[model samples]
Target chain A: MTVLATPQPTISASETGTETVPLLEVENLSTEFATHAGTLRAVDGVSMSMTAGEVLGIVGESGSGKSVTALSILGLIRAPGRVSGGSIRFQNHGELLTKSASEMRKIRGDMISMIFQEPMTSLNPVFRVGWQIAEALRLHRNMSKAEATERAAELLERVGIASPRKRVSEFPHQLSGGMRQRVMIAMAMACAPKLLLADEPTTALDVTVQAQILDLMVQLKEEDGAAVMLITHDLGVIAEMAQKVAVMYAGVVMEEADVGELFDEPLHPYTQGLLNSIPRGHSRGSALKAIPGIVPNLLHLPTGCRFRDRCPAAHAPCGKAEPPLQRMPDSARKVRCWLHHPEPPK
Target chain B: MRNYLLKRLAQTIPVLFGISVLVFSMLHLAPGDPADLLLGPDATPEAVAELRSDMGLDRPLVVQYGAWAGRILQGDFGRSVVLNRAVLPEILKRFKNTAILTAGALVFAVIFGIGIGILAAVFHQTAFDSTAMLVALAGLSMPTFFTGIAGILIFAMGMQVLPSSGMYPARGGDFFDLLRHLVMPAITLGAVSAAILARMTRSAMLEVIQQDFIRTARAKGVSERGVVWVHALRNAAITIVTVLGMQIGYLLGGSVITEAVFSWPGLGQMMVRAIQARDYPTVQGGVLLIAMSFVFINLAVDLIYAWIDPRIRYS
Candidate 1:
């Protein structure tokens, strides 16, 4: 309710691709884990806005906290890790952070649902796959058992699994890895939420299956008219599916831009290095350009820019302090770099 | 499921044969003359030899074993040397007494052990968890005989609310009286197994609650209670049952010390008395029955495990 008035969507020549009405607005979100050694700030001051029906991909390396940010939006962080400060406004539901646990439960798997990375371990093994799919319907929609079972079968068919009725009663272990992921998708879409949060949805699948899952997710999203917040480390996936992409590093979003803009002219050095690291057929003779240095430990992050130690263009100013995310001059893109913001934190 | 059950049952035959042979040989091989124990040390050699020959103890070792094994295969456990009564009937009567105590203990252990374990795992690292675990540790270390004696003093002697020993009061007693006598013995006997079950259940549940499926359950908007009781507990059940099944094997062997302390007329007490007098038939019969029950209980546990996990059944 305390949201700043969203400016009117101006039909511009540059095609920023964010002119649609906003569906999710996350403002200065911070999530921290209290470990034995110290507090680990996994996701800090992350802000992003996604319009309805848009697929916004958040891309980062393993420990860059992209997964944590998605978990924060869904109120899914468990013990030791908590959403320390944030405001997540989803559609007309108001501030998600202020909602009680029960209230949040009502929203989850209803207006917003999530699909995790490992489908093999994601579904309860003892329960039938259909029962798992039907569970969300029973929880949020209060569908009767028979009704939910019918819906579950239809969902399986919709996800391109043949002979849904027979597959419905089968256990997760009986299914292939690709089939299990499809079942997970069916479970997520059981209630047909306005938003879907998929964290590395295809990272654990075969190469061909990965492409199929990606295509199926996009196709289902289009058919259902639900926006997707895809968290992944694959730039190719983002290029193929997302309209806007956010590149994250060490718990902060380093750059946010249109997917095409990111792949064509990455504003941040980290993004530039990530794109260059992709080993292509034509560049087989030359060695790949991998980003230097390792991800800093979250508990003991340096005093300045997180990417500074590894950034090829690091200078004296980059060591002093971190830079804020600011809008680029010509388009609806943002970057957090000393080159982009010479004044630094101030 | 049928195939698995049948397979488990068939596999018990060789195991039963081995157990029977061990039981028969162990009692017979022990250094003791049944006739000497029967007659006093003052008995004449003529009388001792006459008694040994009369009892067929003078027969060759292989012949005696063959006769014993043949009679046992015909469902005859022979007669107790001391009591001069049928060993099968005597053991059966004693087994009934032991079953009552074991059944009561099973109820107590399941209710308190699993309940506290689940609660402890759910509230792990909290004061309740620490306190419950500490109590379980004490329960495990404390012997049943000591607990049974203390329980007798506290509840039977001092309070005068319960019978001190036996399946019932000396005079004819009702079912209520039987229960009154059973309370102390059951608690004392079950204490150790309950502690073991609690530890197993806690660790199993802790492991299951950390699985991705548990997170999936949470994401589905399942209540916290449902997430734990339904999802986590179901996954933990196989491990918990394996421990419980092993405990049943020990339980059937009878809580010997607890029964003795309470003066309960169970097979453990009978076996102890029979052994004191070298009553070979009674000792062999009681032990063989217990070993057979242990095998059957293990089979039952395997069936339960197969039921809980489909992978085991289908594979």
Candidate 2:
């Protein structure tokens, strides 16, 4: 893997003796979906925290419940899917899980916002791009139509769209995919939200456009100083953008560490497998190390560690019981494997 | 836009010509002669022959069609053989009455259909949605004429609340009174169309509600009402509008049966009377007018589609 050493501050103000709190704190979050077979536990007791101005990258394969965790935080899960248990507390906003629907409405788009994958489908096709952005301003900022429209054009320009005044009147279908994503970014940044949840924002774009979008996100993050939770399966994105990383597998966090520490000495077997699977320049001709087996079905997950089926280092004790996420001694890293447990099984 | 409209208008000529030819031939092939029907059975054969010859029925079919077509081109619909009045004036008089009933029924259909449809969609799979769908299904299965008869039996006979037949009561009341007389027939005529509109609206709303744009709207902190009505409903409108257009054409064409059941003095009833009397010119005129109205309504619908969807532009 090509590791880009991007400088990011890992410590928040609270750690520097200030009384500032973490930007977001999630505890024991569980989400379920009702199916004909039974209740499928899609997200099983996952928890993480982020501080102001931090970029926390969550890396996981498909069906690992990364997106569900994001949706659960935003309270966007709909019928057949639900957040069964959890306490999500923001710095200024109280427990989000306990907030009324209307209270959540006020917080969303104003205090926190989201940018989704597939910009082509994320925007309302019938509406003008400028109008869409202006809608957020009008709703949250209480700006007049003219003022909101003017600000929308300014936002479009800020997101590097050329001739934003002209682009404002155009509908989404008339714009290119890259332009649409820029428009989405402009909309998400409309109210200067304190936190932004980006779910694979560049997965659908071309590589060149993806680079540009990432650069734009970095620039916006610096300018606004808003905390972001970036969710993706691409390890390269985590190396380039994240200060903290969380490795998730089958709805459980397999490892959580500072990005540098996690890359240098990945403690969990699943995290080690993930890092080794990445092809390096020196090993171009050699067979890449691929993780064995797929993610277990959430409805019938094994009784022990969820990754035991695919772990190359599994032994007799691996299947005996589930492993708890425990902090390592003399390190700010956590791993959910028996090998890292204080007393390893004999 | 102008060019497209002109082209659409030009296309109607062929349609109207085909209709005229079809109506003329069908009336000619039917086993009835206008002169014989007009004349008494006791009349002599010489008298019947003189009457047919005077009325130009003795001419060849092609010649008679040519004469009728030429007069139509000059804005003359010939004269009604049985009524002994100009065909154009009599048809216009009846068309006005049918237009009133049709318009009333259409208004009722749109308001109730769209309302019920939005309600059902917002409620989705809830009990309200199921019950609304069931009522719509019932409406779809029952024919308008059957509903008209049933309406008359209940409203007119049992409750004695409404006048069962005619455009106005025998006492000849005012406009509101005419509207009162119009209620049962309009509801009967509008029921099936309303059901169709509701179902279309519900399906369209369901499809639109699942779109990513709806999710985006909800994420923007827009209320559920705004998400459902403003964001989802507008996207779903193209299908609903198309269905409404089709229903409008059906209403205009199908109102004849409703008109007949209620004894309303509309072109439908007049056409039925003309067909029974073997009045070829009057029948031809009425059918032509109805066909033209249908074509025009479809044209209006096309224009409406352009208005509702920004992607659809007339060049």
Q: Is the docking of candidate 2 incorrect, acceptable, medium or high quality?
A: medium
Task: Note the Cα lDDT for every prediction shown.
Answer: 0.89, 0.88
After superposition, candidate 1 runs with Cα above 4 Å error: A1-21, A342-346, B33-67
The global Cα lDDT (0 to 1) of model 2 is 0.88
**Pick by lDDT: which candidate is best?**
1
Best by TM-score: 1
Q: Give a tens-digit lDDT track for model 2, residues A126-221.
A: 788999999999999999999999999999999999999999988898889999999999999999888899999999999999999999999998
Task: Give the alpha carbon lDDT tens digit for every residue of B12-115 in model 1.
Answer: 99999899789878766787677887898999999999999987789987787788889999989989988999999999999999989998888788888998
TM-score of chain A of 2: 0.94
Count residue pairs with overlapping backbones in model 1. Answer: 0
For model 2 chain B, the run of ten residues with the poorest summed lDDT: B306-315
What tens-digit string does per-residue lDDT give for candidate 1 at A9-47? 353413543344478999999999999999999998999
